[model samples]
Target: MGLAKVSSFLLVILFLINGGSSTTFTIVNQCNYTVWPGLLSGAGTAPLPTTGFQLSSSESRLISIPAAWSGRIWGRTLCNQNETTGRFTCVTGDCASSQIECSGAGAIPPATLAEFTLNGAENLDFYDVSLVDGYNLPMTIVPNGGANGVGKCNTAGCAADLNGVCPEQLKVTVEAAGTTGVACKSACEAFGTPEFCCSGAFGTPDTCKPSEYAVFFKNACPTAYSYAYDDGTSTFTCSGADYVITFCPSVSSI
Candidate 1:
């Protein structure tokens, strides 16, 4: 066979062997305490090998995400599994299923979310660290190991402890003693008003401009999504790059 034909044959074999395309995500836990990482695949998407797992402090794990997959990931803290029932529960980022797998359930509001839509048109990946639900853990997403195409591929997330400064009304307090202010809830989740939730008449970008609560989040994590419609500046794009999602990349008070 000619040289060009030989190269094409090799490419075909590689593709078949690998079952097409995918990306690697290195999930890291840098907090002082352990965190349970939870994964939830988007509607009509195939799930990963494990939906939830334990990550001791400063631990890391690699996850393979298939091409065109969309999903959301978050960290759950202070979790315990019932020995008798085998049901699991967490103080933060709890899904209704009450099991480790999450099994098609998404995280409840007030939990920091790392959202991703991979291998979209032009082979680009779209991702963001979103606080629209609220804030529980500090997280960051960095593109690595590829020619990440243009347009703000810079790392994005909340690295600060928004909980420390969270307004009283938005603070999520656990009934168990010594677990107060563990998470900071969004105004939308706390108030459930049309203006805060961006629903009803306040559904449009023009209508739902940033309120004082959103401003607080935006000030702390400038690159992260502060509210439901914080799209233009918060969304990030990259092409053919592996990602590192680090929870609590740096220690912060409160």
Candidate 2:
């Protein structure tokens, strides 16, 4: 029995030495907000991805701590606004124009506004989306064939657009961050691809953030790139079109 106990203790030590150790951590945005891509940096100049992990609104992410990650938790929040959900929206807050590209994607862009800051035991970052529906012009341009291009939004933050004007402003708010207390509503499980509608304001849905990218645009004409919309009545252009954005707690990996 003593030999068996000794064997078990040695096994545990081996596991620890093999770098199979794990830690469960939680960053509660007790402020009634959502901290996106909540980056975590520990013991180094750069932060690490809390990846291969799953997290719940109230749950923590289980991460495999690397031996090389020794610095302390050092990371900043980085977010910018992008694209319209698919509704009738445009500049000047006008919803009466069919020419205006709209979206039903419910996202309040600037999702958790408080402006760029770091989030760590030493620093709790804050952000607020200030991207209004306008242009997106990134200093570093990467054209997607057509007018589709990356740009900055009003010198404030990053944004996506069809051209000239943004499909809609990427709104960022500054309210305390909090969880919906619910998981992402099961991918709209009712009928055809779920379709969210807008109440008033800009005739668009407040599609929340971490705006994903599209694999193909409805159209792209060398100098122009646009996304599909409204049963195909019009397409968003990415020519002079751009949405600019400014973010702090700067992300080196944007």
Best by lDDT: 1
lDDT, each prediction: 0.87, 0.25
Best by TM-score: 1
Evaluate model 2: give its lDDT: 0.25
lDDT of 2 by residue, 85-112 (tens): 4333322222222222111111222121
* lDDT by residue (tens digit), candidate 1, 34-117: 999999999888779888889999899999988778999999988899999988998899886778778778887779999999
In each prediction, how many residue pairs overlap at the backbone (N, C-alpha, C within less than 3 A)? 1, 67
Scored against the true structure, residue 29 in model 1 reaches a CA lDDT of 94
RMSD of 1: 3.1
The superposed Cα distance between candidate 1 and the true structure at residue 89, in angstroms, equals 0.3
Error of 1 at 134 (Å): 0.7
Worst lDDT run of 10 residues, candidate 1, spans 145-154
